[model samples]
Target: MQTIETVVNVTSERQITVQLPPDIPTGEYDIVIVINESVKSEKLAGEKKIKTLKFSAYPVGLVADNFTFRREDLYDR
Candidate 1:
């Protein structure tokens, strides 16, 4: 996969202008956009902040310690 790094300006219309490298051949490619939090702009002031959670692994140690209950314990009143 070819990685191209460039800065894009977000217009007043809430659209980003991305310019692909000229050396890149014409073909469909997956695009991933990441915004830097350090770069503040007035355009983002009105926009609502979005909270995102990153992928996490299950706590195997915690589950193992908590899974000591017997099968009958689950069905008991």
Candidate 2:
């Protein structure tokens, strides 16, 4: 497992884009994107806003829109 860091400017799009590689390894990993300098929330600790996202992405498998699904409404069998 490895950790990658990304940085974006504070103008224009101001967004970070990511894509998975075509060839994926045979294991499980996680991608953690953290914006250290964002003021998009109410801060109680000295005006330092912290946004945390810990996403779980599979290497090679079917992906879903939601983590949990209601099988009664989607499936009959």
Candidate 3:
């Protein structure tokens, strides 16, 4: 089984056309289509706001205050 993802433009006449890769054999196969309304609305609006995640740095005291990392520590000597 193979999966291919691609975007298709809908015509004003309410039609959509999809072009499959040449490697896909010429035969009838079961397929599924999913339409994302949220994505369509964002594209029509012409503007989108991106949300970013913010983080605060604090010491949890998981290690000693004077602890340091060394390459040798990664393996048992």
Candidate 4:
């Protein structure tokens, strides 16, 4: 697995997004994503979990306001 750090510009229509690998296997997994912390800043403004995809190691389309992340096709669509 790869650990990636990226910057997302937040504005009137943008929020931070953190995505997983494209292919996920079946099992149990945990995910954590945070945003808006510069090295000089002292507070942790954002720390969140992608909490819509059923929490299975394999799921699909974790989403929130202006943000989304996915790694698998959890449904038959």
* lDDT score, candidate 2, position 55: 94
- Model 1 residue 3 CA deviation (Å) reads 2.2
Better of 1 and 4 by TM-score: 1
Clashing pairs in 1: none
Each prediction's total of clashing residue pairs, residues at least 3 apart in sequence or on different chains, is: 0, 0, 0, 0
Worst 10 residues of 3 by lDDT: 65-74
Per-residue error for 9 in candidate 4, Å, reads: 0.8
Assess candidate 4 and give its TM-score to the true structure.
Answer: 0.25
The residue-by-residue lDDT of candidate 1 on 1-77, one tens digit each, is: 77777777779998987777798889787888888665554445547565668998876564555666678756766
Taken over the whole model, the C-alpha lDDT of each candidate is: 0.71, 0.60, 0.80, 0.54
**Poorest lDDT segment (10 consecutive residues) of candidate 1:** 37-46
TM-scores of the models, in the order given: 0.45, 0.25, 0.53, 0.25
Model 3 CA RMSD to the hidden true structure, in angstroms: 7.0
Task: List residue ranges in candidate 3 displaced over 4 A.
Answer: 47-77
Better of 1 and 3 by lDDT: 3
Q: Which candidate achieves the best TM-score against the true structure?
A: 3
Put the candidates in TM-score order, highest first.
3, 1, 4, 2
Which wins on lDDT, candidate 3 or candidate 4? 3
lDDT of 4 by residue, 2-49 (tens): 466665556676665545456766678675666545632533334433
